[model samples]
Target: MKKLLFFYFLLIGFYTYGQVGIGTAMPDPSAQLDVTVAAGDKGVLLPRVALINTTDQTTITNGNVESLLVYNTATQNNVTPGYYYWYNGSWRRLTALGDHPETITTLVNNTDGSYTYTSEDGTMTTFTVGGMMVDNGDGTYTFTNPDGTNVTIQGVSQALTILSYDNNTGMISYIDENSTLTQLDMSLAIDSWETLTDLKLNPDNIHLDYTDEDGVTNQIDLTTLVQNLETLTTIVANADGTFTYTDENGNATQIDISNLETLTSLALNADGKTLEYTDESGTVTTVDLSSVITNFETITTLVDNGDGTYTYTNESGNTTVIDVNNTETLTELVLSTDNSTLTYTDENGNDTIINLKTVVQANQKTTTLADGVNTTVSSTVSGDNTAWQVNVATAKGANNTQNSTLGVVKEADSNPTVNIANDGSLSVNLENTNDIKEVSGNYTVLPNDTILLGNASTADVSIVMPNPVGKKGKTITIKKQDTNEDYYINVYGNINGLSQLYTALPYSGWQLTSDGTQWKITNKF
Candidate 1:
């Protein structure tokens, strides 16, 4: 029996190691393939496949492979529940299909149903299910293990479409319900610059509290904004970070600058009027704007004349000169007393004279008398040797009347008295009446028509003698007989103190007459 068994083992080794046709004998397991094997030939030894895994093993046969490849063979679905493949001299076993779940991590979900797959070796591949493909935008996708470790799948340009990304990494992906496509968290969007809003930044923004070019203020709180402007159109932050805004009509405006010390230039157009600026020192100055302005409709120019007066001239050539604070209009003119003449010059340049005289006469005038005219007065004498003179001192004089008792001639005791009337009539009165006395001698009245008086008061004595008297002996005598003795007197005087003689008796009262109207006299002694 032993000899028979040795021979049996040898024959089985030969059949196993050598190649056999479809009709060749079956070989034992430990033998090399007796089949004709070429270099780079890949075929299965049927006994080696069955010997390594007695229940389940993969085998390769020559007639079933093309050239040197081993084609398909049935899997050991019911045998040892393991994986095996025939190669070299043995069959190798693999873990069963359910040994562990496939370690698949979903990195990106494209719009297509295709998924990108990766193995434990870090080898990457794409698998499709239900004829779907992913469009990964920018030709890339991410593959991840189940634990979220990621490997990038690039060159997906034509294969997959990207839908969203991780909020933090910005990794892109295809859309899937299971995939988290996070943008910036909506809560963190406040810090994100891409999504800013007017509602979010208006009253809360410090930059909005600002001013504009026009010196108007703008956007603060809504209450402050309304206080600044009724409404606004737009707001802009300058490069200096100062804020300014526009109105509804898009006009840039500013608020009044309360503290304007920093202003370098101010632009104001107050044409046709004076521009006044008041500084902090309470000094006011008027800006010279004549060259910059065209019309000064309400402006008034006042020029000062050093004498506390001013002159104003309008566009029309009318000028008004005013005393500084006096309200009187200049009308009346007074020429000083030193001025000799007052000349009035009219518009035609003609002068009219108005001269002042020394003194003015109203009615009376003074004049001198005409030459050769005579003035007369009636003069009378009342003493002895009375005479009348023509043109004596002060035009006329009268001497005393005749008195023969003493026979002494003297001037009139009183000044000659004359009475004259405006009608050229004259009258005379003797100023020395006591100088007349009784004549007791023969005192001849010259021219010889005389009578010596007896008592003419009791006797009517009238003497009418000759018209022509004797030249050598003109004589007269008188005798007194009432006494007891004879008394004789004679008074006669020559014409030239030698021939004429006259006498008169003593009488208490006497009278002489020559036609009572011409010459008549009476003496009482």
Candidate 2:
């Protein structure tokens, strides 16, 4: 009776192909222990193991239980309390989400005409250019290159491997080490026989090459004839994150760059926040140079604070008030080997002295001597010419002045008229030509002489002007005092050896100005 009950409890009656079903007599042929649940019934129940925290998960690793499911009692970082399944290397959250899509299938022709191939990860690829092989109905395939080169492969069981390459032009495809995806419309050759890091364009030339372990480069050849490129095409920038290019036939094509992640691709945008540049592939690439490039200097304008400071904008647009304390101007500075004593030459060639030693020595003092238009001060500001005067006087002394002078005076009327020798003298008494007016007919004028031609002479009188030896830019004025006198006065001491003759009209005047070597009549009536 126990044996009969055991048989009934286990199978109920039907058993086929060593399979059993709980709710249904007929079991799935593919499953050994198939259980069919009725509607509204709970699904399969997995073993429950609660983890208080993530650290406890380490203990479960001892068992070679891959794909084992477990529930978390607490949250871990951003992960919430949920069921996680052991995956290839880590725990993956399992939710009642959509299932993975079936692998997209593809057909590829190999060197062998009669062959089939599947990628490492069963994925679909449609290559339109570079080189393509056609599968002949008779187990043979023909591969044609852009330059009209062809190759035949025997029927094989594997898929044809493909890679990307870059031509000098923008039509190219390849991924860089940085996970950058590139596409190319140019001719390229790919093979599964060798692992290729990249088929990139050389920076110095248009050739693409492969670098070996020994750092040697092998030229990668491609078909030079590109029938797709019948015309010249170039890419341009648009408001949207896409590249605009006109095909050789002049058809406009827009390439989506919205998925691109960096500012290195400025055709994408270049507003300080973004930038774009052509990479080694002859393709424009962009990286988020924002962290790399910035308006840190662009949005900034300098403002000179009325104080000795200035203000400029930092990247934040906030004003940064800073004194120019971190800069030095080397106009004509000469420093000692120890950088202790420094010398500065001003515009006027006067030097300023800085004795670093004097900073600590009471007797030694820092001295600076500069000459301003009307003043000269050292290490201090002054409106008076004291500092300049001292330098000038010291330099202009008996042996200091530009030109040395011996006490040789050019006497005028008498009274030591003009003392050429400024020996120990601080003042020069100038001859007063304002009060003296002499009546003269014709005579050569002296240095300090003032003459008035009042008498009318019958003969043509020649009046010689004074020699302008030491005089520069000095003017001489002569007036006919008598109104009734009309005399013909001839003048000399000019470049032409004859001055502009003055017709003595009453109260008329003749003025002669000297240009050091020659005298010219400036005013004549």
Candidate 3:
């Protein structure tokens, strides 16, 4: 029965400690252990803060324990290799060691009491081995390697390999010297860029290169050309933001005014005329010009009035006044004049009449006139000692005899005195024969002749008269002083002087022609 009891206890112990035993949330105090804990006052090996070596199941003092905290002991059996072991009585962190953290069933503790983890995909091998324990003070401890590499605990294993860094300087150094830098990366910088689109310009301000609607070519620089838009056809903006167009010349015009506010002025030299302008509001507003001047000849008029005034008479005898000083004011000025009576005001204001034709009459004197009596007379006519015999006779009675009828008698004087009656009848008295008996017998007296009857010695004579002469216009007149004396008078229409006449019978029996063509002797009757 004891053996049976012993087997029962064995079964009970198996139930308590074997793999089939009930697992405890806490390790048992009396369980067979791989490491022992020292009693109280084991200075640095206080069970709660010490690590025991599970491999030899030995109590490790200060020299054997790596730290005050429990460390994972992986080499010993029955010691849950990672994280913690049954020691004085608490759990501790450890390092994990496995091919992959995902497949890891165990982990190891580091000398610094930190935990390490691994990855499943060879992505991470060991998080930290013998990592430094950092008190983050936030219930988390960071692990680091002796070279100060960062540690990661993941998936119950270490799946990361960390590069070490200097905590003080942040410097990184390679554990291996076999690697080299190959290439680098870079970028680019820019200043500015812009794009201009279609723009139209003023025709008067800017010159365009284009085929205008009228098919003209206008080309100009931004500085010196006026666009005659009258000829532009179409305008286009080029890729360079310049303008181009077609003009009447069928040529292309280009304009490159980038950002100008106004185009520059240009001078034109064409013909004798010029085209100029000033710009305003993008248009040419003030346009002015000077012409190519010319000259011409002028005409002038002369006025008889030297005071620069003119008098004009029309066919109707009307007069007009005009000023000659002003050329622009001169219209048609008709002038006229008449005869020697033409008169005008002289410069001295004198009324001066110019006489070119005037008539003058000469003075004349007559000698004898017997009232109610007729007589024959003769006298000596003299001018400057040139003497001639003059016989004066008158019209006779019906008997062809002197009215006195002294009969036929003789006359002695070559010149006789004569009295003329109003009836122009005359009688003669002989110089010596005065008796009626001596004057008896029928007697006859002739004109222009002195007749002596009975004898040539008698002083009585009969004067003869010729036919009456016609009166002629004379340049000068001569008058006889004594009316009682009968004088032979000579008359001439025109005379150079008294020396130019013939001496024939003086003027007693002479007849003068009207035009002075000839002189002839006529018989006294």
Best by lDDT: 2
Off by over 4 Å in 2: 1-414, 418-425, 432-435, 457-460, 495-500
Best by TM-score: 2
The C-alpha lDDT values of all candidates are: 0.36, 0.51, 0.33
lDDT of 1: 0.36
lDDT for predicted candidate 2 compared with the true structure: 0.51
How high a TM-score does candidate 1 get?
0.17
lDDT tens digits, residue span 1-525, model 1 = 999999999998876556544323543344443443346556654332222243323344332222222222444444343445444544445565776686433333344754443334444444333322233576766554323345565564334333543433324345444453422221121122122123223544543545443446566565665444232234333454243434343345332322222211111234633434333333444444342222212113445565644454443444555442322211211222444333433334455554422111112133333323343334456873334443312323334534322322233354534445566465554432212323343333434323343223333232223322332233322222222123433322222223322233443222323332232223323
Residue 121 local lDDT, model 3:
30
**Candidate 2 structure quality by residue, lDDT tens digits, 1-525:** 999999886784455547878788788888988888878566876655655443345647476267777775556564456777776656677766444554432334433432232334543333444236587767777766545567675665534343433223323344544455534333123222223244567775646788764567887444343322222334444665454544333445555635423221123243534334443234543434233112111322445454545454443455645443333332344555554565655435678886634432323224456674434454434672233333222222255675754332334455654344446443345555423444456677767654445444554456677777666777777776654554655565763356455655666667777778877667776
lDDT of 3 at 86: 42
Worst 10 residues of 3 by lDDT: 184-193
- The Cα RMSD of model 1 versus the native structure comes to 73.8
* Candidate numbers sorted by TM-score from highest down: 2, 1, 3
